[model samples]
Target: MKKSTFLVFIIVYLFFSISGFLFPFDSDWYRTLAKPDWTPDGSVIGIIWAILFGFIALSTAIVYQERGFGRHNSEYMSLLGINYILNQVFSYLQFNLHALFATFMDALFITITTLLLIFLAGRQNRFAGWLLLPYFLWTAFATYLSWLFYSLN
Candidate 1:
């Protein structure tokens, strides 16, 4: 992987992370709404995301290292980036609007795209795919959580 690609990924990832953290922290009005039984504690969300982001960064590095899929890497990266960006929108809709049900749709979109990315990454290197296993699992869990939240709150 080129240094530039890692740099870009870090920059973009940090931007999303910071923006998401600050945005939710600033929105107390929405936080007051009822949440499901298993809704993660906000601080726990931060911790989990930090670790997850590290895994994502590592997977990006692995994909970039795969010389065989140079062209395909860009395609996979773009797909992953689109899903990441859409997730930011999901963050806003889920929290700010309190649109629990609509948020489920966004989560579902992410889950599908994530699964696709996992497949793409696997084609490049199994390690790359393995790195994303946590992401897939987390998103899958989040999907179920969203469904529960949608039904209850």
Candidate 2:
């Protein structure tokens, strides 16, 4: 992949990462909730997301490099777009709106879409698909956490 193209993907994914800052979590509200003892620290979550976003950007760039936005690869591109949007929207739903159930559902979709992206990317580029494995695992774990939050609180 061209360095410029990869940089662009990194920039776009970084923009999506800003949602956490845009909708900063309500710490006071968060404190009131019944969280599991095993819940990760907020800083840890932030770091994990930062790493995942990097992975996502690289994976996307690889896929785009291998298969541009041609008609034959439209589904791959479409899924990327959808997954990005869904990924950004989770912050608003969870932190801003305080919608636990909705956030849980959003996380669920994110997990599902990540899996689909893995499958699709694998067909085009094995490395790209493998790159998303951490993202998929994290999202699956996140979906479980979301469900726990919804059910516990």
Candidate 1: worst-modelled 10 consecutive residues by lDDT: 22-31
Candidate 1 colliding pairs: none
Alpha carbon lDDT at 143, candidate 2 = 98
Tens-digit lDDT track of model 2 for 95-126: 88999999999999999999999999989999
Per-residue lDDT for 45 in model 1?
76
Off by over 4 Å in 1: 5-9, 15-18, 26-31, 68-70
lDDT of each: 0.75, 0.88
Which number leads on TM-score?
2
TM-score of each: 0.83, 0.93
RMSD of each: 2.6, 1.3
